[model samples]
Target: MSALRIEGYVIVSADGMLANAKHVMPDSLRFKGDQEFFNAALDRTGLIVHGRHSFEGQPNSPKRKRLILTSKTAALAADPSNPNAVLWNPAGATFDEACDCAGVRSGTVAIIGGPEVFAMFLDRYDTFWLSQAPHVRLPGGQPCLPGVPERSPQAILAAHGLKPGEPQILDASHDVSVTPWRRAG
Candidate 1:
């Protein structure tokens, strides 16, 4: 079987932070245009992967299939609150096996992340939709990818061999921009 086509979607601050020091996405970090962009991406995404923290307290559970990355569970099991979500332990199931279990075939798999989740798929992503809120800054916040010297989002993407495309200015007043990067040929 062919490998999965993984794509990642993330919103970082100009300083390269994904979340505040509290490790939570605050209201200050969210922009309407970014929300719309993510919603649109979700519409076409067949499967989604995200960290446990990213899935917690989500106002509403989406209907699409989702894999919540958690090491606490060894077996894949349904989330009690959201029927469409499942707890996934990557150590136990390979991506292919997880797809098989989810009854998903070849298609775009979007990963909404916490830093580690982003780091894990560094070399596996076919595309990464990176958004930035330049006006937003959270001092001592979580870097986009941890365990390495913090760097700009572009630098991180380029290091992983992903080339950035033209950026879309989502909200000029808010300084929100989104760039789509694909693996370089």
Candidate 2:
């Protein structure tokens, strides 16, 4: 079977909200640790998948093969200059079908997200790379995985067969922890 991986940089408060929902990646929040984790995951991934909003938020680059998933037909367009980019409508096709069309075989397929995208592929993902920011609070922020009713992300991941592998404290000042999870066979 082909492998799917869920990976994202999340800034969570002590209360468990993932981010300010208004912004996917806020400039106000520092991500030095997340950057390092992303680099490592990128090294192993052959393709990346993301929601339309996340794709739009990214800096345009031709380096990686990317698939943007959306229900709306107009959410994405071909990048004439970058032939590696593909717009995938999940309504018309399954994520696996999209990956096959993109030529992502057994190698890692990184799912970078907005919550809906994460929720969509959580069951199929083989691994998870998460950045957990400790001791912060975003009272009105959006949850990392929405609609879960304040469950521990770690426990949820464990339930999905993902075991914690590598963990490092990124910043002593901010107490952000970068952790990697691998599927238990």
Candidate 3:
């Protein structure tokens, strides 16, 4: 398999839910800094890969190429709804093929997520930019990653050889912060 530098970006609540129970980003978690950080990070990404659920309700659509990962796509094909988007099934197409379908040649690819999307790239991420709102906790929210009920996000990333850097405050008043988890040298 060819090596691809896939980076990830996510925002979570303290209890480790990427979204609330309704599977939507909570209004309480919205912050300008997190949005800005993600946008700036995307500037370095050549292609984006995200889950179908996350794509359907996106607030900020990407102007660049994207590959929406979905089980619904039996074959790799262009996404009908998006000009610069492709629908990809990893089992049906190689990463390179999917990138080609999305018109991306090479460079960093950003893995934006729902839990399933995040889990798919556990060992693939070169770095994961994790933003958090520590003040908020969604009691019955969706977990950050699936199949890792025994582990915290930190432990799961650590198992995948990712080491988190010191959390940098995104918003002091709201206790929003971001940590970059890099593949350890």
Candidate 4:
């Protein structure tokens, strides 16, 4: 294990969903404040780890040093389209191996999401930046974590030993706020 600081970042609706049933994030969930916050945080990261859907959803993703989680590949393979990315299969290779492939030996590793990708790093996150669009609700939508429909997002984080800090309001007009959930000492 390298001295990697893993962090998770996500925004969810009132019902704790990341996207609609179609696995698409609707307009209601997109807030200027949240986008600004996410972008600023990502800029400070050394590496980005996410799934295919997340990769496609983010802007300027090809320019960043990242590992795209995928089961399609055997373990680790070069991403032909993006010179900065590598395809990683966690089952076939360790996180360290993926980092090596991406040449990210240390520093912060930002885990941006899509359910399965978010869930994979639950126990490993040093901090998880959870933003909320309290006014939005996605029924029968995709969860931010595996236990979401059955449990609240906060509860799941607490269960995984992460405690929520005081929330910072991102957009007061839209009632958007972000909380950093950190591992308990």
TM-scores of all candidate predictions against the true structure: 0.91, 0.80, 0.91, 0.96
Better of 1 and 4 by lDDT: 4
lDDT of 2 by residue, 61-159 (tens): 357888887665543445454588778887777667777777776677777776777777667766676777776666667666765436877777677
Tens-place lDDT digits, model 1, residues 119-177: 88889889999999988888888887864335677888888899999999988899899
Off by over 4 Å in 1: 1-3, 56-60, 147-149
For residue 126, give model 2's deviation from the true position in Å.
Answer: 2.0
Best candidate, lDDT-wise? 4
**Candidate 2 accuracy as lDDT:** 0.66
Name model 2 segments beyond 4 Å from true.
3-11, 55-60, 74-82
List runs of model 3 lying over 4 Å from the truth.
Answer: 1-3, 56-62, 147-149
lDDT of 3 by residue, 1-185 (tens): 24468888888888888888888888887887887788777776788888887752344465767888877888698778888899999888887788877767768889888788888889888898888888888878887887433577878888899999998888888989999999999
Q: lDDT of each structure? A: 0.82, 0.66, 0.81, 0.91
Sort every candidate by TM-score, greatest first: 4, 1, 3, 2
In angstroms, the error of model 1 at 119 is: 1.1
Error of 1 at 34 (Å): 0.8
The true-structure Cα RMSD of candidate 2 reads 3.2
CA RMSD of all predictions: 2.0, 3.2, 2.1, 1.2
Please give the RMSD of candidate 1 to the true structure: 2.0
Clashing pairs in 4: none
